[model samples]
Target: MAVAETQGIEPVDLAAGSEIDEYILDDGVFKGGMSTLRTATNSVDKKVMIKFFVQETSYQRELSSLYSLQKAESRNVISLIDYFEAEEEDEWFPQSVIVLELGTVSLQHWAHGKRPVSEVYLKSILLDILGGLESMYTAGLVHCDLKPGNIMQFTCPGREQGIWKLIDFDCACKYSAI
Candidate 1:
């Protein structure tokens, strides 16, 4: 579908527009981490998943990740398409927002990693993810949070299948020399 086409999904209304968007349905994502639903009304008619830096400990690194990925290639890494800060703040958390491609329902959703995703498919996902990481590493960045919640799956309407997208750069620190 054209990027200009608005996917029919509704935008996650941030009552206060902050780091934690209560407007997004809690059920939108598979995990407990903060989330925001991104509906494209003008392009790409579909639901875009957004993960937030709900925790304060790793927030700074997110900025670094965003900057590092800015220089990386498109397909290998989860590109940082755009970013915005919500002037509206929650009673408690700081106002912050980062846009990224939505990952899959959660690889471990089946049984806490017990029910493994297809080996062949999983390998393909990891390839893309690692390539991105390797590129980041070359650029002198360290993505500390390499857990399940941080990896999202990217699927397009025209594409026959989806690919794994490494996300949540909130914990990605610049440990290497630029």
Candidate 2:
């Protein structure tokens, strides 16, 4: 992987025990209101995605929300492998790195292509989305930013390709008590 200066700081190189390594920053593939997405390889040569939060507060909010979802252990939600705060001398605030499983593609990309998916696949994706939403609802969290980009496709064993999963909890929030 090539090294480049991002936001005036070098990409972080994670050490052992971090569950991931060779943390080289790649081109930003997806951009969201709270974070930028890049692809990376983990220790075992598995391809993963890293979400680099632009601000510390945004990082904290996302971490907290993910932690809640983690406790739920919902399969429909994105699986967070690990996260850490990168310590850098040149940076004012440490960068929070959230490692997630790399999806085959985002739903947005598929939809934008204007190709029609099989009805069975479409139903599967829809059910998966609702399942994820129900899990969030059970945890008392609301996924405020539900969109095609936030919904990803992955290949599941014993099933055809394009199994969809809901991702991105940066803007997710707890429901207000009534």
Candidate 3:
């Protein structure tokens, strides 16, 4: 879908079957206040989520945090698969793109749909979130936004429960910056 320009940032004109690099865009598109998210598949047909940042500052903040967490290989944190800048014709600034692992649902939505979860399941979710926080601390970064909406759940085929992961580090910053 073609997203109209917002806040002086031109959106990437993508539709179903459109190709960006080796990733094929799907029909899914989610527009946010500062970014746009689309579902896509890579060369190997692995499902992924693509985020296009409207502001360079937000893009850089998220990129920095993702890079640090990527090196730590924290399972509790969302994995950053790849990133690049997609330049548009005559556009002074290029759109910053970030490829990430696809998540089934946000923690807020999941909790709202399902009734009270089992105690064990609740414990597991808390532990997973804590693990993500610990990983961030170890990397000398802090996630300024830690809400249910920023937490995602990844469904595992063999596992009884989905894995909870922390996501959206646009507001995150280094400890030294705090």
Clashing pairs in 3: none
User: Which ranges in model 3 have alpha carbons more than 4 Å from their true place?
Assistant: 1-13, 86-93
Among the numbered candidates, top lDDT falls to: 3
The candidate, 2 or 3, that scores higher on TM-score is: 3
Position 25, candidate 1: lDDT: 25
Pairs in steric clash, model 2: none
Candidate 3 or 1, higher TM-score: 3
Instruction: Report the lDDT tens digits of candidate 2 across residue range 1-178.
Output: 2223233442343322232246554444566667767777766677788887877777777788878887887888888888878667635335677888888878898888666778977888899899889888877899888999889988789877657888888788899659
Q: How would you encode candidate 1's per-residue C-alpha lDDT over 35-135 as one tens digit per residue? A: 44443211343334454445444444675666767676636557664555533343233435565555555444522745556897667767867886777
The number of residue pairs in model 1 that clash at the backbone is 11
Candidate 2: lDDT of 138? 77
lDDT for position 49 in model 1: 49
Q: Give per-residue lDDT, candidate 3, residue 105.
A: 92
Those runs of model 1 whose alpha carbons end farther than 4 Å from true positions after fitting are 1-46, 51-60, 86-94, 110-119, 156-159
Q: What TM-score against the true fold does each predicted structure earn?
A: 0.61, 0.80, 0.87
How accurate locally is residue 35 in candidate 3, as Cα lDDT from 0 to 100?
A: 92
